[model samples]
Target: MASVTDLQYVALAVPDLAAEREFFGQTWGLTEVGEEDGMVYFAAEGMPHPYVIRLRRDDERKTDLVGFSAASREDVDALFEQVKAAGAKIIAEPGPVEGLAGDYGFRFFDPDGRAMEVVTGGAQRAHRTLGKGEAIPVGISHVVFHSPNHPALVEFYQRALGFRLSDWIGDFMGFLRCNSAHHRIAVLPGPPALNHIAFDVASVDELMRGLARMHESGIHLSWGPGRHTAGDNTFCYFITPNGNAVEYTSDLEHVDEATWVPTTYQPGPNTIDQWGTGRIITGNVPHAEMTPDKGLWQVPA
Candidate 1:
């Protein structure tokens, strides 16, 4: 069966669209690529597509939907069939997306009711390489979800989308990869909410500079500027104005499916942070405030 190759984007619903735009564009350094019907798109420098994060204005703040790019158009059709065969909720029938260049896909609700899209052939945006001090993400690296029914969600992704198991933090968290960058999606045992969204950066300097830039601009981190043992990626997480977690990360471990062996790691102090130094600040925004929604783009106008 044709499979998903990599994550394309994520849609989110926020109480304030302006705050989401300013936080992602000015503070996070992402470019505002386009907007329509109160929905805004943000993209990194040199991004091939129009946007990576789609935000919609709403009364409540929450995750909207996650988009994954299939290897080809054929793969998209195949996955749609698989999703239907698995008895999941189909939100949108397979078709082209408006304002997105030649894009054809469909939307569905995951086992936990989170919206997801399988798309191919979206419009490309104008490109520019990253320069000094700009912290715009190169691309969305991964998205983590607090899935209460861990076994069911894990099984759904693996069975329907052809996602492979990367690793597990015991039964508390499980990592699944569609591509090579460790895990593109993580399912954590909890209520239906967003854990965090990660972005790729050039180097350690870039990641630290992003942290510094956010600090100078009066944006502080919720947790991180540390390394995670699982993906082996360096991270710096901060709370967005809309009360959600966003991470700037680098050096994510890439796995070779043929030789890679999945491992189960028990929860420990150092399991989450290899550095074991950053304090865990669990609170309203990145913690309690981040719930799931049908991302701004997917919600009806």
Candidate 2:
């Protein structure tokens, strides 16, 4: 069974549900889809649930990354078995998530402690509702995480979750593809920190408009308006209603089975984003030249 159809929403637990909704609703153009108990869900109107951020924070801006959807129903079942075989404990059975519909899925923890899910209804439901976010900044495009043992964690998802590498950003940052979407998940080798959440815009122009709104609203711009060397997305990063970084991205490259190649590149100021937008020393990231042992594998970085 093949894995990954598209990114289903990466659920985030936010302390202030209303405030988070208000910010993303007004600013990011998300529409509130009511709530369960105290948890509110927002459908990024045009995007699949990929942009829906859940309100269930146990701590400050902490999101347990649940990787997105799988392409086929068989793939979803395959992932469930694969997860168990791969040593991840099942938190939820492969079925409906209670509140969400058309989604037959399950949640499992990856090798590095990241929680992920596999489903079939992911992109389809969002597609039927809003078509595609190509006209607006759709929903969650990717989630980047920082953790130790980049190789083990990345390998776990690739083998168990049906994710493929889109491009390798040095030895530490890897862009992975699930379905036809360019890169749905990216892992930056880490001492462990949650990096950012991304939303796709209709066009690079839409992305810039979102960035401009974020700037006018006084949120800090972390990086972007540059094309990435790995995913080749024209993107901009900013702090969200909560402390987590959020990104508005556009025009990311796509990968197919035919020309799918795992290529490597060296990371530098100019190399991170070829159009020159990604700036800032994110952290103590090991460069490609420095790490002789690492290459593009399903592992973390």
Candidate 3:
């Protein structure tokens, strides 16, 4: 099994580049770094390149999840083998992206057709003007994936990628970690577009301030300005310029290698929000009416 050394950046095929840049820039303070072939990349000053969002052209099929940046090239080699062994489909073989820096990796699809990958060392970190955690703290923290086969997939990450299970928000969400930074990725039970990508913040107050900015700018809040019992992180969701969800979060439970117990089980949403996650109906979300079940599972991953 290969270890999931670290979480690389995620690549989402966005429809609009200008909109995403304005959304991410205004909401999270991301700066537009570079562009190529109708695709634009935005970055947080803290995280490195290829982590940027890739805007797709009209004729291209939209890509859902493209995971990137593992801890080691060796781990990548090992997981590449594991992915093959599991009978998962492979698209691009592992290698270097000709035009990008440090993005030496490959592409494949998750069970649901999500374009996932393992990459590293592409594009140097330019650091965004805005990062997770301000006075409330800041920076992009982690991503969560939805899977129907939780245990089977958990083994994939645990055995092949070496993600230590941090805790379980519910039977649906499994918080996994690679580094001391609480969690890099979360495995959730299937069907929605990945739950959302969270960007770290300094405090709940900062989250509020950031939310205020979003509100004033007409960016409707998605989920909350509340706290979750799982990691003890304060969270709020906003629609980013990319149509991708970004969370402004703070105060997650800090753990050391010693006390960090990888556990699981479904927790009630009430426990998920102790500080009170404000009312969140599908209406607040952009495509809510279409996804009455909280998600549209059939979207090509």
**lDDT tens digits, residues 40-98, model 2?**
66677665553356655444455544556666667778778878888886767677655
Per TM-score, the best of the predicted structures is 1
Clashing pairs in 1: 64-295
Once fitted onto the true fold, the runs of candidate 2 whose alpha carbons sit more than 4 angstroms away are 48-51, 57-59, 64-67, 71-73, 101-103, 121-136, 278-301
lDDT of 1 by residue, 8-84 (tens): 88788888888778999888878887788878888878567567888988888767778888767788899999899
Q: Which candidate order results from sorting by TM-score in descending order?
A: 1, 2, 3
Q: What is the TM-score of candidate 1?
A: 0.91
Residue range with the least summed lDDT across 10 consecutive positions in model 2 = 292-301
**TM-score of every candidate:** 0.91, 0.83, 0.81
Give Cα-based local distance difference scores for all models: 0.79, 0.65, 0.63
Q: In model 2, state the lDDT of residue 212.
A: 77
Query: Which candidate number maximizes lDDT?
Result: 1
User: Per-residue lDDT for 1-301 in model 3, tens only?
Assistant: 5665555555555556556666765556655667776656666655655444444433322344456567666767777887777767787777765545365666676555566767766655655444333532235588776666766666666654567778876566677777777777776665434657777766677777878888888888887767777787888887765556667787777669788776664576567667554545544431221121222222322
Which parts of model 1 have CA positions greater than 4 angstroms off? 126-129, 132-134, 280-301
